[model samples]
Target: MTSSLFYHVSGDGQPLVWLHGWGVNGSIFLPTVTQLSQYRSYCVDLPGFGDSQPQPGTIDDWAELLIAQLPANAIWLGWSLGGLVATRIAQRWPQKIRGLITIASSPCFMAQTTPPWPGIAATVLQQFTQQLEQDLQRTVERFMALQAMGSNSARDDIRHIKELVLSKPLPNATALAQGLEMLQQTDLRQELPHIALPWLRFWGKLDGLVPRRVSTLLPQTPQSQDIILPGASHAPFISHPEDFLHHLRDWLQTTNKGV
Candidate 1:
C-alpha cells in the first residue's frame, strides 16, 4: 500500500472523510474543516498525490482502494475530482455512506451533448494536459491559478492552494496524467439515481471549472439540496468560508437533526 493514501484525522463525532480535488492533497479543506469541529474529520490524500503511493489500476480501482481505507460508514465531503470519487462511492455503495457534500464539483467535467454549465473547452483541457506532460510543476501552478480565477481573494487563495500542493511533494507524472484522464472520461449523470443518502451540493456561482447549472444533472430527491455561493469561484471552501460553513451547518442540522 502506498503511503500517499494516508489520512490526517482530527476533531470528534461521526466520521467525516474529506476527499480533495486533483493536483492537491487533503489540506485544501483546512478552512472548512476548521469550522466542522463537531465531526471526526479524516482528510485523505489521493494516491500518489501526497504521502500516498501510486495505485496500479483504473480509476475505479483507485477509488475502491481509497474507499476501503476509510471507516465503514461516514459522511463524505469531496471537492472537485474528489467529488467524482464521492459520487462513485454513493452510487456503488450507498449503504456505506451516511451523507455526501460536494463542493465546486460537477457530474461531468468534460463537455457533453447536453452541457452542464459552461466548462473549459476540450481543446483547453487538451492543452493543459499537454502542458502537464511537459512540466508537471508548472502545470500544477497553472491549475491552481485557474481555481482561483475571478476571486477577490485570488492571491491568498492561490498561495494557500500552492502551499497545499507543495505540502506533499509533487505527485509523479504518471499520476498526474491518470488524474487528467479520469477527468476527461468520467460521466456521472446516469449514475446519480443510485445514490440514496442525503446530498448537499455546493457551488461557486463564478466557478469557471464546474458550471453552476450542472447541479441539475443529479437525481432529485427530498434529501438533496443545492446551494450557490455568490461572488465565489471554484474554491468556496476558502473564498467563502462563512457562507460555506453556514450552508453546511444548516444542511447538517436539517438532515441529521443538528450536528
Candidate 2:
C-alpha cells in the first residue's frame, strides 16, 4: 500500500490535500502549492500518473486507498477529473475532509442538451482517447493546450503546463484513457449536498473544457461559494496564478475563521 500511490508533502500548518487533473500528475500543482505557505500541502499522484503505480479499479476503490495514504481531516483540493474523486471521498467519508475546493471541475463532465449540463463535448474526449493510442505525447500535449485555450496568456500557460508535465514521468496510456472515460461517465450532482463541509468552486470565464456556465448548473450546497476568473481558462492557477491565489488564499482564511 505504501508504494501503491505517491504523495509529496510541503509547507507547514493545516493540512491541504491536492489532486491533479487527467493527463497530468500531482506535480502540476507545484507552482500554486509553493506559493501557499499557510497550510501543509499533500500533493498526490493519482494511480498511473506521476510516481504512482498504475492500479485498476473504480474511483470508489481508489478513494479508500487515497484517504489511507494521506492525513485524514484535511481540506481537499482537486482539479478537473480529480475533483470527481475528491467529491466521492467527501460523500463516503465526510470526516476525512474539513473542506472541499474544486477548480474547473463539473459534477457531470459530458454535455447534455436536454438537462443543459455544461461540459466538454463527448466527441472531443473520444478523439483524445483515440489519439492517445497513436501518439501519447502529442495527445497529452494537445489536452494541455486545450486547458489553456482562450486565456490571454494561453501561450505561456501551455508552455508552463507542458514543462511541468515533462518534469515528471508521463502518465500510463491506460490511465490517461481511463481518466477520459471517467470524465465522460462520472456525475456527482446528487451527492453535492452530502458535502456539508465548507466548499469553494473555481472556474475560468474562458474555459472550454469545464465551461464557466457549469458554475450556475451545479446543485447548490450549504456554505458553498463560486468564483470565476475573467481572464483564465481551464487551468486558471497556471493562467492567472496571482488572481487564482488571491481568491484561494482569501477563501481559505475566511473558511479557517468559520470552520
Which one wins on lDDT?
2
Per-residue accuracy of model 2 over 201-244 as CA lDDT, tens digit each: 99999988888888887767668999999988899999889999
Per-residue accuracy of model 1 over 1-259 as CA lDDT, tens digit each:
4434778888888789899888888877766677788988999888778777888666687778877889967889989988988888888888887899998887778876553345557887898788986888888888888998987788898998887668778876777778888788887778788677899999988898988877766678987899999888999988888888889888876877742
* Root-mean-square deviation (CA) per prediction: 1.9, 1.3
Cα TM-score per model: 0.94, 0.96
Model 2 pairs whose backbones collide: none
What are the Cα lDDT values of the candidates? 0.82, 0.87
* Runs in model 2 lying further than 4 Å from the true structure: 1-3
> What's the lDDT of the predicted structure labeled candidate 1?
0.82
- Candidate 2's error at 128, in angstroms? 1.1
